[model samples]
Target: MQNLTPQTILKEKFGYDNFRTGQLDVIEKVLAHKHALAIMPTGGGKSITYQLPAMLFDGITLVISPLISLMKDQVDGLDAMGIDATFLNSTLSGQVQAQRMSDLRSGYYKMLYVSPERLEISSFFDFIQQLPIELVAIDEAHVMSQWGHDFRPSYLNILPLLAKIPGNPAVLGLTATATDRVRQNLQQLLGVADEDTILTGFARDNLALKIAHNVDKRQYVQEYLRENKDQSGIIYAATRKQVDELYEFLNKKGVKAGHYHAGLPERERQAMQEAFLFDEVQVMVATNAFGMGINKPNVRFVIHYSVPGNIEAYYQEIGRAGRDGLPAEAVLLYAPQDIHLQEFFVQKSEGTEEHKQNEYNKIREMNAFANTQSCLPRYLLGYFGEIVDHDCGHCSNCLDSREMVDVTTDSQRVLANVVRMNQSFGKAMVAKVLKGSQDATVKKYDYLMKLPTYGLMKDRTLKDLSSFIDYLTADGYLRIEGGEFPVLKVTEIGARVLKGQLVVEKRVNRRVIAQQKVTSAAKGLKLSESDNKLFAELKSKRLELAREAGIPPFLIFSDKTLMNMAILRPQTDEEFLAISGVGEKKFDIYHKEFADVIVKQH
Candidate 1:
């Protein structure tokens, strides 16, 4: 091992002047031979934590990753930087795998990537014993937890693999999203204590989180794509059928798009992934299986075609956008019925009764997030055990200028109806009874018909009553029990509302809350006309250079770098190097090309 610090290695090899937040600390712990569990947001430079240590260690570092594509991307990136890295996965031929294993035993590589399932093979485990493994890094560590949103059974095999390695190499667990419960589970599984675990804040200020309720989703998405034609993004659907339909719609409309689902042949899926990564396609319509290991840095937006089953899934999916530190958007087009689809999935999923109930609770929280009027970022942070002292002005709730109206009367009526029915029914039945439906179920219960609170909301439409009921439930005025059949019940908070001791207010028309005009791409930038023209010119130049280099545009220079170049009008090599992301390697290659553009314009 070389006597070099992480800072020296980072500058000499990676060309980055400084470490991002929480990176140096985690790297220090690992270098000290202590275990670490890092929970960082996407694009948080997590790979460097282990990669840096691998360079400084005397022996090889084995990285157990969750996805083949992710490992390929990382290895390719490392190779581009002239670093020695390789991966062992199903994609490799048997002869090639043998050669790589031979190289591993010969100590020809510094880092090796393999799937957790590979560790379960007796022959593979024995083969690895020939090499000195100094560190074992587990990526997407949350999968080790059975309660996590993305649970993989094969991940549990890693524990035995560690025990077989000689000298007991240090361990590092890395993940992008984990709630407090999942975090604890990860710590326990990885044998790391509380102090060794570092949680970087989940706030992504550059991402504008917006939820569009009850809109014509197809029309809305079409319009959005039309406006953002030059940008790259992902549109995530809830089902494979939806993915195929949206892909067809976009293709018929002449949008540069591709679709992906598990049903597609492996070759076709690989083709689609490469097309999107190379910018041959501007939009990728996929199911949730698409983004676990995607390292595309310049994705400008992510649109959820439907609400995901849990907040953790939603957060991780949206984290794919704004990775280049440029402003991006996360738009969720939701309807009340999306929850039913997720509930059906939970019921069908094979798990214990407690696991199913946990899924149900997470689904309820997801529903609340979709309908929340509070700050979206605040709610997400609180869900992950972080307390933000103020609202994040970037989300839809903070941007909304609508007024709140008192709904105390409606709340009291809903609570009274729940009580009068003796809290034995569900939301649909309560809504039906409140709206005075003459259906057989309502008519069969004579006592429900005789209650004074029955038909109290007859003047309102069922849709409107249902909306208010959802609002009350989300606001804690009511609670729903979990099971195959959920029963509606009044909490102490609901009783207080019924007794007039508490007042409730909510946005008047929940559907119309997000009806304001969709924000223009340049709304928040506050750029002048000349700056906007310069930005366009710089972006065109970036595209031209990217084509010549045969790499993603962001790899050459991020959108944020171009934006800074446009605004600052760097006139010399030194000035260009001063811009963020313009390190020595990039400055040496394209400084003059960018400087000439700026100087000519100025």
Candidate 2:
């Protein structure tokens, strides 16, 4: 544990020559025995921050993880790298737990991953006091914040557990997605200072963010899978029924796929996870419960079968794909009506009124994101408080070649109606009044018919008017007051638009276009026929080696690594080592097998 820097640990153990952004800084903070709060996107190398420190520290690092699958995946990955790591969770038998506890007492492990609930046992706290724990790393730290998208009441126990420990150990809180408020909450709860919170940009340039509105999602997904058959991907539905239906549809269509949801038995879920991780299945259809702790790096696409609960959940879910810094697609199939499902969930969620209101606000933002005409990446980044001067140039909005039409007249009509209603109504009421609805609610206020703005937009459908209201609200022209039933009110900007002081423009989806097909490999890496053949051969070899070694294929070699091998045609051990991801350890294990493939091709 002495004289070991993060750089050497990364190279010798993890087979990487350089650290991704924000990793080294977090590692340095941990090494210096300082508390750190790191907000890195998924696949941004968060585990390495504390893992490297664990290697360099004289005592063990205790990781507070939320999910058993996540803990197992991390521990398995570390064990594969020749690092000593173990997880204690409900999955272990009593005997196994006792053995792990005994090992902890004897100082036999460098890292231990556990759930926060485990800390509630006073005896376990006593056991921890005996261990020389140098650091306590909290993964998915956002869950500790009740304001976060994913809130777990159990996570609140972490601070109490740390308090019981003998000495104040360095604390590292990590999450893939956290807003300024959530970050502040974590900082306060973990006792980390503002300066110690490190946030890398949330933008993932390699992910092509697209929102496909008003399309036959099933057909679109089928076509996408057919186009990218050789690649691995995940399709996330919002319910167990949808997961089953999608899984059945794909299976009937002859796609090698599997389904996962909470409804499935524990064994079945684990099998499905292992199947997907081992590349035995090319596509996974699952609910939101399926992917929190998965570490598969070669997923080429992630299609949201339905809109997620919030932007934070959406970003974190899509972050699962393209972990290897390769081009990937995150296509969200959105329908305006689909929002009802989320609203229903929010209403049914176990939380206070304020929590529900916060969730509703987040859902509104997510809905705006789906319908935004601006660059998807820019909108998402802005939501997370990151300002980008330019369009991401890769998302659906930026890539869309459609023309934006001036909707000032329509905007004025909507804003004027809100004013006529005295700004005390909701979006539905405004839309209904504008569309000249004779419904009882609209008729209840007989004065509505007398208003000049009433029936002014009768020629427009209610759906279109509703969408416009949504746009106006999101564009800062209008605001929705929070409550059981929100009232749409005009902001200063809306007042200006109503007074003809400002103009508005929005993208109109004139007609739906076919989704663009991207390659399975990294974008822009076109290989010739011979090179393609060599690439396939190398991939087959890599998969075979992965199976023989009982590990995930990406662990053996990422798709990027295999592509480099095919392109570089590295024929010797030394030549292979020059390729990225091929360090001395990997070279010692895989060079002969992969190099022979290249040499034979030559």
RMSD each, Å: 19.2, 20.3
Write down the worst ten-residue block by lDDT for model 1. Answer: 513-522
List the candidates' TM-scores in order: 0.83, 0.84
lDDT of each: 0.87, 0.87
Q: Roughly what TM-score does model 1 have, to 2 decimal places?
A: 0.83
Tens digits of per-residue lDDT for model 1, 1-602: 46788999999888999999999999999988788899999989899999989999989999999888678888999888777999999999999999999999898999999998888888998888878998999999989998799889899877867878987788999998899999999888888999999999898989999999899999999999999999999999999999999999999999999999999998899899999999999999999989887889999999999999999999999999999999999999989888899999989989889988888988888887888788998889898899999998879888886658777888888898998898999888899999888899888887888889888888677887887777777767788886768888898988998899998878653323221111121234456788788888888888899999898989988877777777767655555666667889988898877777887789
Candidate 2 lDDT over 427-497, as tens digits, reads: 99999999999999999999997899889887677887888788887777888887568899899988888
lDDT of 1 at 334: 89
- Which residue runs does candidate 2 get wrong by more than 4 Å? 509-602
Worst 10 residues of 2 by lDDT: 511-520
Candidate 1 lDDT at 357 equals 89
